[model samples]
Target: MLIGTVGNEPYQRVSSDNGPYEGAMLGAAIGAGGAGAGIFGARMHYKGIDNRAKRHISAIESREPVIQRKINKVNEQAENPRMSFIQKAKSKIADSGINQINNLRTAQLDSLNSKNEQLRNVVDSMQHTNPNVANEADLSRRSHYAQSYADINSHYDDVIQGSRFSKMKQQVDQSMEHKQARIEKNRDVKVSRLNKELEKLSDGRHKWGEDGVKLMKQKHPYAHVKGIGRSAAAIGAGALIGGGAGMILGGLTDEVNKHVKQ
Candidate 1:
């Protein structure tokens, strides 16, 4: 009985020692697996943050050029007088659906205004500097200049479409053309009659040739009126025709080449 009990005691102790060893090995394996998973998760998180920062930097670099270009354009505009003039004129003469015409008008007005201001300022400065220059003769000359300025301004007032001023100017021009034509036609008829009368007066004058025959009765001023009347009539008719031709050309030029495109 004593030998059997000692044998049983060694077997029980062996079983107890085997349980603790197996448990320790399993616990070590679980700890190693958890540590590896945490390391992988931390690496993934840091890499995602790095990629996001790179994309943000790239986006900022792309937009920087557009912003810089606008700033440069503004700086150029601030320094340029011609550009400022164009902008001012454009504000005055803009319209829908006609950018080219508006730009042309802006340029034209800019040039015209700049020239006018320069001339005006020079005159003002001269008068201010030399009081002696403002004598009677000088004042008369200045008055004449002012009259010339008024005449030029009267010729080309800004007559926008759909305005009463435009309608009035058009009507006045038409009336002037009609009246001038009538005067020209009447003068032509009068000249033709005078030429016929001269031929009758110098019918038998041997001293006067065909061309000079109109001057036959030079001494008889009261007795014959042919030469003088005929010559005056011819000159008047020539003047009328020349003026009419000039008027036609001027009208055509005005229509084809407008001062203001808009």
Candidate 2:
């Protein structure tokens, strides 16, 4: 049995021997065990949240390089211009025309060479068979073939350097330049957009990491403290209930023994 006082008021005797002390010790042990389990669970939960956030951040960061590569590819393509279909067709036509002109020049030159060779043979025969006739013959006429060859070459040059051919070539070049300019402009816009997206992603990753750290710092400790508080409350409640029950049982036993003795 035990007796105590609270605030100048004398409390009733607790009939069970060591009832309050044993119950309190038992309740505290149980509460501590429960608190430890709750703490472990809370810690695991916090760790899981942190790890999940980190994984999400890592995933976002991985996409950063992929987007950057796309930007680089776009820029590279912009640097190297591609001819349009129309321009390519025009160029092919121009080349064909030039080939035809060259073929004609070659045929004319070959014919002139054949005629010149026949004249040379005649001159050689005259010089060997009749020296007087060879001297009297207008040998300067042989130079006409060389002049004709030069004229054919000049005509070829004139056709190649003609205004029509030059204009066609210039148009093709201008078209390609225009196409390249458009590509470069589009690449600039696209690259700018991608760069902005990368910036946003970088910011998001940073914020996510910071928020995860902040959340863990703020919530984990609070959760642990809350669990501890609940366990403390459980201990107090269990002790109070157990001690009251033990005292009641002890008083009943004392009364029963007394009656048996009587």
Best by TM-score: 2
Model 1 residue runs over 4 Å out of place are 1-24, 36-145, 158-262
Candidate 1 backbone collisions, by pair = none
Q: Rate the local accuracy (lDDT) of all candidates.
A: 0.45, 0.69
**True-structure RMSD for candidate 1:** 56.0
- Tell me the tens digit of each residue's lDDT in model 1 across 44-104: 5544543554454455455556555654554454343232354434443433313444455
Q: What's the true lDDT of residue 198 in model 2?
A: 92
Against the hidden reference, what TM-scores do the models get? 0.22, 0.46
Q: Candidate 2, which segments miss by more than 4 Å at Cα?
A: 1-47, 99-158, 208-227, 230-262
lDDT score, residue 192, model 2? 93
